[model samples]
Target: MAYDADTSIDLTQYRSLIDLIESSAKRYGDKTAYVCLGKATSFNEIERDSRYFAAYLQHHTELQVGDRIAIQLPNITQFVIAAYGAIRAGLVLVNTNPLYTERELIHQFNDSGAKALVVLSDLLPTLNNVVASTQLKTVITTHALDLIAPQPQSQCEFTTITFTKVLAEGSCLAFTPVSAKLEDLAALQYTGGTTGLSKGAMLSHRNLIANAMQIKSRLSDRLVQGEEIFVAPLPVYHIYAFMVNLVLYFERGGCSVLIPNPRDIASLIKTLSEHPFTGFAGLNTLFVGLCHQPEFKSLNFSHLKVTISGGTALTQAAANVWQATTGCTISEGYGLSETSPVVSLNAPGLEQLGTIGKPVIETQVKILDLNDQEVPPGETGELAVKGPQVMSGYWNKPQETAMVMTQDGYFKTGDIAIATEDGFHKIVDRKKDMIIVSGFNVYPNEVEEVLSAHKEILECAVIGVEHEHSGEAVKAVIVLSSLSQDLEQTKADILRYCREQLTAYKVPKIIEFMESLPKSTVGKILRRELRN
Candidate 1:
């Protein structure tokens, strides 16, 4: 399908991401830019704080241009400050999840070669245990409400710097603006490695700027400069929310209400009640959970207009109930971590439920058979994409990158999709067996690796099972070396061990014991048989 005339946007307006941020701050200086914890931050304030942060990093820390700095934070005003500051200082941003376990943290920090990290104070205890293992030198910590309310803070047990101290000291130093090119490496977005360990997808400045423009063009009708307010319940650390809240919406002169904890449904509803929000961004689990709440059901959605669904598939039940409750239909979109994350999005009034809408502007999609040949329309095949929004390749893994990229330059999405006669596409299945729990990717290989480390487990395989709340959940089928009569205790003990090694979502919900798993002559476990 050709690019929709309605969603067409100029792709080359911004020279760099810094250009995008500074220009927007110039245009909407006094307007409200972000809201969190009952405090509103203005565009001018973001620009100023971020500038101070840049000056501090340049003078105080040994971090230089092109170095990597990780930001492990929730949706707060300080995240905006640290990200923009790091960008302005000519450093690459590594958006790390605060919920990451020590094992996961060690891999990402080491892989990215991150020398510095700005993290929430609550994560300090765990981080203190593993910071020495990585190449990290400077650690900056802050409370979630630290910037919102200037209170006396106790020093961290480990030697570290405070966020407020950086700002205060940076004010005395002079900041020299660093030159940036569109091709410069901006951020290292790590993907859930379905086949193995997660690898960083190097996103360039051009890729991010173009994606922001592409997504804005898709929502051209709904977004108004300086007039739109969006409630953001998604984690900003994820690329989906990162692109939307920090880049796309901020550049458009809009306000984003940041929700620190989305699992607290009552608090989220109460926060929604406080703002006459014009937009909301969420996925299936959030939509279903919110609609079932009595307080959410009774709230006034009179001003809500645009609701976006991404990060996972939108269920028919979720779509139906959301529209009935808010009188607004969700524009479900599709993308992967390798695509700057927005491949296609359904327009508000024209959304076709159960199908991802047309490809965004300047994006091309092809359905390919197992032989790498394009399949005829109305048939399911692996979806491949070519566009400005696609990442250059996997970071530092040239061979792995070459495997995914075709000779023709399209990136194989590893998803089974059907190209309809109408422009919209339906994702029927996945070519890779990757589980998505609560809109977060949970790869079986990673979980299996952790499980195999246990002394009791001889053989193990992980698979995704149907879950009503999270869309899909991780299930482990195992064969222990010795059969024990106390099955319940073994399960509980294994679960406890898993919680220590894996992130919350990656932990298997169900554990089933079997004599042996079905395997081929080559001795490879078949996850499909386990699923069956």
Candidate 2:
């Protein structure tokens, strides 16, 4: 888990990822940086657009240096412009899920104290309701076609400030040059709020650049200078996809075939069949979902050289089906929002089918017990990581941040894993009671806490149950203080309340009523016992 030798990346090439785009704009100015819905954005065009947006934000808005800006958009080209523009403006970025509810959206916006938000048109209603309570002032919205050229600018149905307006306003605004250091905070990635509440992991520019290089060094041969093609279906808001597909891939001047909506499996299959891809990265359920589709067998993946799976364990069955359909194995890996999302991965050259491979270049991983003592190899323990890619700390939550970080700068991942002799590692369990439903982490503690607050429920416990489509489904066991006079109506009420408060994946599928609950000797609820 510990590296004795050096794992340094050459810093002479570029100071940060933004610098990579700037450098590429100079070298491969006319090359395509992004491809979406048959429309492409050239490297030079991207640079000019981002710089203009950055200049506009700095001059028009009162956002100071290091102020956070929330970005909630899909896999469209605006995401790239907004992301790079925020960074270039010397502001930290806070990526948000477009599917978040008003409550979930409010929590993150307030927690990060975001000064502005650049969101898609469709998700504006969710943001509009909560903007009053949050510190956010400037709200910039764009349509999907705004990023693509040769389209009429007046063809947008969205109701907000458009890109055209921003450019016009920026005409008279004064531009101030600001220098952003390599070690400055770049992103505040919020953890998957499955445990209790989400915490923002503060990642610096150096952390993100180092992680990209770590991945680049491992697959340098497969990824040519400017010819690499990646199938980017995962949500850009998620850390895994953002780092691998958006940040790292774009920094290399590579091409990404964007899948705006992955839920449409048929459309995804057609898109894959039409294009040639060199790399594909996603979670276990995505591969499983595709393989189960009847049309998946007809797609051609002969050109694919590298495949990666993360965010959860790669089930053995899913791996076999993928390898059988395509001549390449699906390399499983592990990471968290705290590690710039790439800590370890199964190297394509030397991969174990069922295990997430060793730590990436410049990263060190260790398995430790509750006492922070190192555990023997092949034994399950909490996975701890220390590297340039690891987050500096959580934003504003000093006590919560200090609770997970070690004195030596290692972040306790809270994931249980066993490291093999061949450096392959397999995830066993998560310290936080979390259920991954449809490749999304659903925290039981958060659900249980919310359910227990209900007037009908006295105590509750939540656990994951096996499911074929979604890897796992949330199931809740409740001990009511008073017997339900109308059981069916009470169940419906609880489900309805959960739907309003939680996301679709986090809602419990099954609700069981109990007269009494299982507990430890100290009267603490035993969630493990409820699993049975």
Best by TM-score: 1
- Give each model a TM-score: 0.98, 0.93
Stretches > 4 Å off in candidate 1: 1-8, 151-157
Candidate 2 lDDT score relative to the true structure: 0.81
**How well is each residue in 101-147 modelled by candidate 1, as lDDT tens digits?**
99999999999999999998888888867788998889988888888
Q: Residue 326: error of model 1 in Å?
A: 0.4
What is the clash count of model 2?
Answer: 1
| lDDT for each residue of candidate 2 in 1-532, tens digit (9 for 90 to 100) | 1221235676567776567657777777888877787787888887777888888998878898889999988888888878887887888999998887788888999999997988777666666568887888888877777655423333233335676567557656666656767788999999865457888999988888888888877665776778888989988889888887767888777888888888898988888877788888877778878887878877778789888888767888888888888888887777888999888877675777777787888778889988888898778899999988988888888888888988888899888889888777788777657788876788888888778888999888899999877878999998887987998899999999998788888889999999888899999888888886
Query: Which candidate has the top score in lDDT?
Result: 1
